[model samples]
Structure formats: structure tokens, C-alpha cells
Target: MWHELFLIPFLTGLLLAVLLPVLGAYLRLREEWLAALAYAHLAAGGALLGLIGSLPPAIGGVGAAVLAGVGKRLFAARLSGGAGYALMLLGGWAVAVLVAANHPLAERLGHAMFDGQLYFADAAMLQLVVAGTAIGLLVLWRLSQQLLLAHLYPDFFRIRGLSAWPTQLGFDVLAALSLALATMSLGVMGAFALVFIPPWLAFRRAASWRAGICWSLVIGLAAYLLAFSLALYFDQPFGPMLAIVLVFFGVLIA
Candidate 1:
């Protein structure tokens, strides 16, 4: 069961490491916030859904991710990014509260949102892994170069008579998808840190985009390995174990 938790997120992160740069380039989104928002919504929504339903966490996670991505894009079109994110967070919290209130099994619901038990994974979880990997690979293959170009230079892309909007929209969707997969596999902590810290550590050490991506991949995989090993040995939560791995490497690198 624990291995199941590790394998899905590990693979998903590896795929994201390979794909995000290209997607960013094509989308012309210079800021990382787009991806961050997409992932955040997915993590929050997945947790809420898991609390309310018997559906596999991954399914709930993925569905919420998709909804959040669409909702965020619409919100951003009308409002500022900050406002959109705040609204999404509030909405997620409300849903969680409502779900917890209505359920007779409120205790189980609360645990599902905040303290996912990775050791409880079963065959359905494996199916989610397979599905997520497949969808991610397909999207990456289709949009890599466009995303790279767009993110690298939105104004230049516009000057070249290319519209960056489609690329941005595509990346938003991909980010949500990746977040859903990671959240379902490794839970919220795993997804959140993977979205933030790996890129941060890589950017600190790297001077170029390519180099940053390479470093992010190394750091992400190393963190996962270290976290899994520690969790197995100490019987600790995998999320905190992974966080410690990131912090340890981050401090060493600093």
C-alpha cells in the first residue's frame, strides 16, 4: 500500500518535470502562479470530495481539479488572479465544512481531508494511477512546444501573430490534471510541495531554463526516495517525510 502511494506520485512528478517547461514555453505564461492556482484548487477539492463520497479519492481529486481549472480560468478572465484564488479557496473550505456537517460519518470525512491514510490504498488506487499517467502523457505530447513558446515570450508570440491564450488555457488544464494525480497518489502535502519547492530549489541553483528543469527533476526524485525510506523506517506520515526530505536538501543546497 505504501509503495502504491510512492509509485504514482513519483511517476507523476517525473512526468511533470519533463513536461512543465515545454508547456510554459508554449503557453507564454511567465509566472508560475497559473500552475500553482490550478494545483491548489485540485488539492483542496480532492480532499473535500474524498470526505463526502465513497468514490476513490483519485476520482474525486481529478474531477475537482478539472472543475477548479475551468472555474479559475473563468474567474481570472473577469477578476484578478489573487481574487480568483481566494474565491476558490473559500469555496473549497465551504464545501468541506458542508460535507463534514451532513455526513453521519463525519469523523471519517474529516480524516480524509486532513490526514489521508496511505496504507489503506487498494486496487482502485492503482487504476487511478494508470489513468492519470495516461492522460498526462497524452496532454504533454500534444502541447509541449506550444506551451514552451508561449511561456517564454508572450509578447513575442503575439508579435509573431500567435495567440497565447490557447496555450495558457491548455497549461491550466494540464496543471490541474497533474495536481489531481499527485494529490490522489501522495495526498495534499506531496502535491503542494512538489508544485512549489522542487522548482524553487532548482531555480535557486540554475541559471538557465533547461538547467532548472534538470535540477528540479533530480531534486524531486531524490526527495521522494528519501521521504519514502524515512516513512517506511519511522512509520511516519509520508507527506511530512517528503517535506523533511525537501527541507534537508534545500538547506544543504543553500
Candidate 2:
């Protein structure tokens, strides 16, 4: 039972506890919250590319995310919040669907991305989740203060012997890579799923940034466990079950 029901959720929740809050904080600080969904979509498309190109799905997802991050940064140079992101998102999804249509594994791949077949995850995927989460958290931790300074005091941070534009862009790429790794576990929704609520809950109530981040981790893990039981009782899939439970938790806290 532990192997069947708990393993994937446990791994996912633990990883998210570390990775999600950092991504959320960065997105909120950078005022680029919309990019989360766009990058997730790009990652999904890249997963499709992986299936077609014989690469690891997460690798493809990260590749797509990096490209999207670079393109968005370049385009943002001219027009802040340009239409390029919307186009990239739509084009990515369209391409993924079109490509999937030609392959026999489309339905399975799509189901895995959106619905998250947690019970069927392989050993390689489990390893990916652990390694990805560890790497993502370490990078974010090392850069957190710098990233925050860049976000809040861009000109000042840059004036103090730092390059704000490059730093911000680098953070975005790292964020996309983290999000892509998340997609490997929670599916397409994995990237941004369960992100907004817990972090919002913590950031709203906590006294300091560090405290807020800690609270966010607690909220996410608790929600995942509660949602796991609810999924079993209600006979529902885990991803959407977790989503619903997260919203419930949000409402309760509110």
C-alpha cells in the first residue's frame, strides 16, 4: 500500500515543499507570474518532443523551458510583457498536440502530463525527482538574496557591482529548469500546480521571508497528504484531487 499509494505523493510533496516556494517567490517578486503557465506549457510541448526524439522527457521539458526563457528575455528587452510569450505558449501547445496526433502514444503521454499517473512512475523517474529537487533547491538557496535584491531594487542592485538584467534572466532560466523538473512528477500541472495558494498563505501571514518560505513548505506537504487520503476515499486521480484539496485549504485559511 505504501508503495502503491504513498511513494509518488510523498516524493512529489517533499520536492514541492522545497522547490515550489522559491519559484513562487521569484515569480511574485519579478512580477512575471504569468510566465509560470507559459513555461509549463512549453515544458509539456518539450515532453512530446522527447517522446519523438528519443530523449528523456524531463530533458526535453527543460530544453523547451530554457529556450522559452531566453526568447522571453530577448523579447522583453524591447517590450516588457510582450505578446511573444502568449504566442510562444499557444504555439508550444499547438505543436505538442499536433505532434502527438501522429504518434500512437499520444493519449498515454497526454494523460501522464495532465492527469499524472503517479502509481506507475518508474525508478528512473523517481531518481529524476530526487536529483532535480536537490539541485533546484540548492541553486535557489544560493541565489535567493541576490535574486531578491535584483527583483526589489533592480537599479541599486545593478549599481552595486552586479548586472541586474543578466541576473534576472539567469534566475528566470533556473526557475524554468526547476519548473520543468517539477513537471516530471506532477505532470504538466506539476510546474505551477499547488504553487499559488500555500505561498500566498505563508507570505500573507508570516513575519519574514524565511518564515514565509517555511510555512509554504508545511502547507504544501500537509495538503498533499490530506489530498492523498481524499483521493483514495473519493476514488479520484491524485493531481486534481490534490488541486481540489489545496483550494479547500486555501478557503479554510482565508
Candidate 3:
């Protein structure tokens, strides 16, 4: 009972603390923070598809994210940002509800994905998340130099023969994959909070890249701890509570 209810929740929060800040910082710097919500909805929709069709959860989640990423890339030249991302977010969320509408376990699954009940997470699921996050961090670390150059010196790339498409593609794929994994592991709400809140706080205060990420990690960890403690004491849902905690801190810090 303790393991099922407490241990997994704690572990998941810890894992998210370290992982999300890095991913969040990258997204904020890239000006793709809105895409996090988009990918999260896509992951939720894809997870519902997996449930309805008996596919692997990650397959559906990652597939939807990749499709969205590709679509964004293709339509970026045409569609304006606000309209494009808004339509995609609505589409993804609508698909999720539609998929879950007639399922036998609709309520339960919907609650799981939307609420992200941390107590219900299993060890295997948590481990998979940890492994995936680890690999993602490594990939980001490897691309750090190029990503910095691209962000700070777009003209520098054009001056060279570097089209920069490959770098963009790599980052997009990684972000999509990370969003998918996080959605599956942490639920849509949890994933959004982790990806959005920390970075929002980090960017406002930090003077340098390293300082920004460090502060993000600190803020994320605090949010996770506070949420966990509050949930345990008040008998509330961990993910939503964490989101609330993050918002509270965001207000205070802002």
C-alpha cells in the first residue's frame, strides 16, 4: 500500500524535478513553449488511441507528437503561430475526448490521463520515464553548443553553408519525444506544469543560461515537494496540487 501510494509518487516527482527544468529551459529559449501544450495534448490523444486500438502507449503518444511536429514544420511557412498552435491544441484535445468517449473504462482512463494520479503509477512505468529522461538530457547536452549558436547567432549559420534544418529537426524530435514520454508518465496536466511553470520562473530571474537552469531545477523541486506534502496531508491529487503549487510560486516569484 505504501509503495503503491507513496513511493511511486515521490519517485515520479523527483524524476520530473531534474528532467523538466532542462527541457523547459530549452523550450523557452527556442520560443516553442506553446508547443509543449500542443505536444501534451497530442500525447494524451495518442494514448487514448493506443487504448482504443490495443497499441503500445508510447507508440500512440510519440506518433501523435511526431505528426504534430512534422505538421508544424510543414505549415510553419504558411500558418501564423497563434492560429496554427491553437488549432492544433484544440484538435489534439478533441481527439482524446472522442477516443475515450465510448471506451469501457472511459472515466477511469480519462481521469488518469487528465489528472495524472501519481499514486497509481507503477515502478516499471516510472523506471521507463527515468531512462527516457536520462537519454533526453544526454542528447540535449550533446547539442548544447549548436543550439546555443543557432539561438544567439542565426546569421552566423546563414553565413556558413549550414541550413540549420537538421539541428531544428533533431531538437523538435527530441522535444516531441520528451513530451510524449512525460505525458505518459506524468499525465497531461502534470506534463504541462512541469514543462511550463519552471521555465517561466527561470527565464525571468536568471542572468545566464546556467543560472536559469539551476533556478528552474530549484523551483521545480520545491514545487514537487510542496505538492507531494500537501497531497499526502490533504488527501488530494498530486499532479493538480503540484500545478497549483507551481502557480502560487510563479505568482510570488513574478
Best by TM-score: 3
Work out the TM-score per prediction.
Answer: 0.78, 0.89, 0.92
Per-residue accuracy of model 2 over 1-254 as CA lDDT, tens digit each: 46645666566656765677667766766666667767777888888888789887778888998888877787786656646657767877787788778886764676677775454566666677777778777877877888887766767764677566666677778777766766656655545655666777777788998888888888887887787677667766667777777788888997
Q: Total clashing residue pairs per candidate?
A: 16, 0, 0
Question: lDDT, candidate 2, residue 25?
Answer: 68
Deviating ranges (above 4 Å) for candidate 3: 1-5
The best candidate in terms of lDDT: 3
* Residue 44 C-alpha lDDT in model 1: 55
Predictions in order: lDDT: 0.60, 0.72, 0.80
Candidate 2 worst ten-residue window by lDDT: 116-125
- The parts of candidate 1 lying over 4 Å away from their true place are 1-29, 33-38, 41-43, 50-56, 101-106
Pairs that collide in candidate 3 are none
lDDT of 3 by residue, 1-254 (tens): 25566787578667867887788888888777888888888888887887778886667888989888777777877876656667777888998888788786654666677887777667766786788778888988888778888999988788987787777777887788788777776678787898899988988988988888889889888888888888888988777888899999989999
**Residue-wise C-alpha lDDT for candidate 1, range 1-254, written one tens digit per residue:** 33656555445444544443333332223455445544644465665566566765556767787777777676776867466666666665566566666775644644543443444445565566566657766776676667666555557777888777676677677777766655554555655666566767777778886777677767777777677667767877666677677788878887
lDDT of 3: 0.80
- Measured on C-alpha atoms, candidate 1 has an lDDT of 0.60
What ordering of candidates by lDDT runs from best to worst?
3, 2, 1
